[model samples]
Target chain A: MELLRPDSAEAAAAALGNGSVALAGGTELVPLLRDGIVRAEKLVELRDVVPRGVDGTRIGAGTTLAELEVDPDIPQALREACSLAASPQLRSMSTLGGNLLQATRCWYWRLNFPCYLHGGDTCHAKAGQHREHAIFGNERCASAHPSDPAAALLALGARLRTTSREFSLVDLYRLPTDEERNVTALEPGEVILELDVPRPEASVYLKAMERRKWSFAIVGVAAARFADSIRLGLAGVAPIPWALSSVADLEQATPLLGTAYKVQIARALVRRAVEAVSAPAGA
Target chain B: MVVELTINGNAYELEAPVGRTLAEVLRLDLGLTGTKIACGEGHCGACTVQLDGVPVLSCITLVHTVGDREVTTIEGLREHPLVEAFVEADATQCGFCTPGQIVTASALLAANASPSDDEIRHAMAGNLCRCGTYPKIERAIHTVAGDGGGS
Candidate 1:
């Protein structure tokens, strides 16, 4: 394999496609590559190619989760999400962009099972062990989106700029379709450049995990309060980070046999997240 | 690819594949067996190493992507207080995860000299002790940090 270290973002974008993958922090991509889940003939390094650091409400895509966790300028929900997303070592090596693009933690997919996401006809988790699978949007696939920060960003009403165009962060994710098995809306060779988040009046992120620390969320909720409205985003509930129109919409969940318990967890977290964000400052 | 890496304060030019992990290059090529590789994936912290003083999973970090950065393994932490503290505190069981644990703890204490018990747990959360020697590991870190130790 060839390692291409492009000095600029344009060069990095140009180097992508045609059997080449973009390398950012290498937290997610490297493991997939090593396990033969994803294949690439070349890796285009983006450490130096993409921008870093925060300028007002705009954050560079190259910012590490550790850096995002402590930056005073970042919103409280995003910082908390970044801190609670992974272990210390992983946060130090994972970038915001990479975190958003990370694949699900479904063992079936990671183990190379012929699931729907792997271009197979069956959703393995739906018929097999799916205790950690999705509770919503699981008609076709049972895998849940594993990103904590994506949920927070979705609640923050974040927008992002790519190499070719700009769009809301919500547009960045989609449920896997028969034509495209991938969950993300990003086309081939497209690269995320940066994100712009509007400051919320108040925000809170709550997550429930199997372990006390360093475990993926069984149900994560991000609630952001604005001047006259509130937005909630959920993780570990669907194939994509799910945005809730209202808390009542959670009732629309159609859980699998083994995943029925997640609906209760999501309800509890969503309640607490809403209460926390709804409280007055310092309450 | 020929990559220039600075490991343990020494610079060396090594030829390795672009897909080869930093842990593989350290163990198989440079013969630095101090850095253990248990999972080969980033799930286990057994392959933890310091990249420019920040703890990172060397198993997932590509060797070619580590250009011009200093890599520090357990061997680089010679005579560090945590090493002795680990012995006095009995922080090892099979000693397989010792190097990764010490490397991670050292970085934590470097940034915060007087971390609370909660801070210590949060920082050391990644380095799993399958033998359940967590209390002793926390004690060792606290001992070096000049604290009485955690609850």
Candidate 2:
């Protein structure tokens, strides 16, 4: 139960050498620690890491979701998705990095069920309640990405600038299978410094929630249109936020039982998001 | 580990466990019962408070992470018109989510004196009221906005 609060990013990354886990915002990590789901002895608090803001095309990973919701420099789709992702209280505490790398919200995992993510041989969601599970990349783990910003980031061509190296935003997550059930590929001691999103011609994010507000996306869509290309990202229907070059790629997605209808919802949302971003002004 | 936090204009150097949540510290250590903890998870805004003038859930907030930020609980709100508006509009049905709702609305009013209906809905989206008093809550917020006592 050792907590290290380093003042600089270098110090923080250096402290994450052993079996320590990085703690940012703690909206996701704290609960897991309290529940005994994660037993890391050391917690490296990254709150003191410098360079936190939403300026120009770069957004510090330490920036909270509340800041992103109102930041003018951010595109409309990212802002909309941020505002709709969680409740006001949660948004104020959840950081951009934590939201991007947070673990699955599946009941089986969070409730300590004997699932593959918990080192069990079988995935309970496949045989149990899986309406909210992934329709793609669900061979061993049926959990969805559960990140609204990740989908929006994928559509906006955002890249993760880590302390060690830079990689595509889509590369952060891995398609979970029995052989490798680890959620993220973030190597030890690698800290997410900031997210770099290239300005796009137009972008939009739309999520279909079970409730009117403050509910996780049943199916979320993020679409961005560049000069002659369009990028689509889908959430709540896959292990990772599914990225596609065009809407026609929807037919190539593998749909699972109990969640096949998500494909239809994703279709409509993708179309609407594309139109919202590509249509002429006041059309 | 010890942490120093300024709550409601008074700085208190409190001794708490490293992993203790702000809500637990407020309720148990400081004896501030106004802040409620419904869902230990961050879903329900029953434990919402103002950290540096922004509404944040105290339940999920770690005690050590608060650092030197100013925390404002329901008890800290001394003379604000939103409190009266809540009573007038009958928004405090069960009074479970009132502190969080008022705190969130205060932040909204601080940022925007007179927020539109859509703005109010979007700002207050995080605080959930199972009592179904949303209409009255919105009315109360509008009532205060109309009074122009924000800030």
Candidate 3:
């Protein structure tokens, strides 16, 4: 295993040319390594390389998710989510970009059961005990978007600032599939330098997991405002952080159960994301 | 490659292989045995240590991830007043979780000198004492934090 530590974001991406690269944070990649879920000949350390700016709350791909929440500028909802996560110790190690890019922690997937997520033909959780899975995009693959910070970012209309390119939240991540490879729209050579939420946006992240600590979500919620429009995103409840139009729009939208708005929005978005996919099992 | 880290006022310039976890570096290589290793995973904070003034798990924390940061182990806190409170309270029944417990408690005190019971519980929740000495642990934390000092 080789350790790659570039001096700058440009250097990092420039180094990532057309090869098997492992983007790491203590949160996602380390656990996968220990679990024997992933093997990498080239291990890149991203924490120190990316520049962190105070004015815009710049976060490097290597910075832990726990560090982001205590940033004082981060929203209260995000702080609560971070505090409620695995623990302060875990938070001290979990990075924001890594959490956002983490693969789904579904039991079937982690257990190496060869489900749809791993390129198998069948999706076990879709028809099985999927209450903990996506509540919305459940037509095929039934895994939840495991990133809690993703929900917060989605609500705030956060964007990814890649080393050589840039894309909005909706653009960067791969479209989710209930039956095939689920990925954020990250290309092979691209390195995530920093994630950006505009200075004007206010956002919050919430998740109802099984335990007090170290558990994934059963139902997650994030609400934020962008260009004066509030968007609500759900995690542990859909394929992506289930995005919806402003709550005011929903109130003005075809009136139904107020409690059922999240579920309905999740169902709608999940269908759209799955419908937009073109790959077979794993692309 | 060779990486130098300042752990608990002692400078360790060691060779860390690619993807070497911090837990392995501390207990296995450094001979600083105060930091315990229960779960190799991030959960179950038996490997908690103070890094750059914040409490973090050593198991998942890679040696390469944190560069040139100051690390405070449980052994370093031996002369601390909090440890005295812990001993007075008899907080450790099995003694396995004490190192992590002391590291976490020191971090909590450093951040907030007079944390409430809820705050103490919240900070210590990550460090699980399977021996179930929570009551005395809570009392010890309160005592060292100068709240109750366990009567």
Candidate 4:
């Protein structure tokens, strides 16, 4: 087993025989190492498979979230979300691909006390203090997924590039099931070459964050414009970014700008996530 | 891991342990010395540096992973106009955050040639000064906008 940062998807695919794990930004991975949750005998670096500058920005799987934040042409809302993902230090090291596939942060999982999230027989967040877990599209594990930009990407109708698969972020966002392989569609060999987003006319990402700098989003919004319509995604509110794509009235998009129902979804999601995980430490 | 990287304009090949920070590599190993290490963690931008033209926290960034990337430290900014302006405005009281401040300020000006006072404040928010010389730093940055080239 050798650590390999392949230059292409084909190379990564060939290297991932069976037990191989995809390594992106090590921000999350390093933490897992500290906690003794997972380990890789062989590492795969995705530096070579970077996206080229073209008509639209093709953010390579390895592109740090900070790099995208500085591009002048990127949508301001998305940029703001990326900027606020964590501290400047973390932003410097973390990548978008890694953010999407991070492990759960539930207290249950953190203490090494096992539940269904790690393939056990029960889910503690279901009837526990699950308030912070999520209200929309939650499952056995009420762990809110880690990516801050995912919500914005879904609303912007971004296209994800992979070695064997490709799709708009919306179609890819079906509710996860027990049979699901991973949170993302990425195979062992596949790499997120770039995320292609069309120009967004109006967008915003409002966040509920702890006073401490490196904390996760307490609750956040990744709302973007459509054809005279609007789609809102709630982050830090669910296991995945909850996209409210069925807003029928296009005119009522920004009710009171920062203080409206569109924004309320993020708050609502937070309340639910907190409810699910509110159990007293153990089962 | 044995990694080869360039700092400012000098090329260096050094053995950096896993979890050994780039900030450590720059200050301890090769002795460039100008880049100070105030906070070992990433909170204080005192250890900030530009990696491939973008400002990043050097403390948390691993040394081995850099792999030939160009790193610009405060030692590299000796003659940069931003440094001169900071000196002209006397933006140094304790002088601890000057390196990080100048490096961060240079990045800001490069991206936005004419930023508003609020924009400048926001850009430098990550880089903190213990003595609160922010007013002087702001004035120094503003000095770059006008046509006057005097100190």
Worst 10 residues of 2 chain A by lDDT: A274-283
Q: lDDT by residue for model 2 over A1-283, one digit each (tens)?
A: 7788887888888888666888988889888988889877788999878458987999999888888998989988799889888887788888899898888889989999978988898889888888888877777788888999999999988998988899999889888766777778898788999999988888989999997678899999998888878888887887788888778888876767888888888888988988888858664
| Residue-level lDDT tens digits of model 3 in A115-136 | 8777787767765545566545
Give model 3's TM-score for chain A to 2 decimal places: 0.78
DockQ of predicted model 1: 0.95
1 versus 3: better TM-score goes to: 1
Worst 10 residues of 3 chain B by lDDT: B142-151
Order of candidate numbers by DockQ, starting with the best:
1, 2, 3, 4
Residue-level lDDT tens digits of model 1 in A96-173:
999999999998999999999999989988888999999988999999999999999999999999888999999998
Q: Report per-candidate DockQ.
A: 0.95, 0.77, 0.67, 0.19
- Please list the residue runs of candidate 2 whose C-alpha ends up more than 4 Å from where it truly belongs after superposition: A279-283, B147-151
Q: Candidate 4 on A161-270: residue-level lDDT in tens?
A: 77777778765544456776245556556666667777765676666765434456666766666445566666665556667655332233332222234336554543
Worst 10 residues of 3 chain A by lDDT: A250-259
lDDT, residue A29, candidate 1? 96
TM-score of chain B, per candidate? Answer: 0.98, 0.95, 0.95, 0.92
Instruction: Report lDDT (Cα) of residue B55, candidate 3.
Output: 84
Which scores greater on DockQ, model 1 or model 2? 1
Residue A159 miss distance in model 4 (angstroms): 3.2
Report per-prediction Cα RMSD to one decimal.
1.4, 2.4, 7.9, 9.0
Docking class of 2: medium
DockQ of 2: 0.77
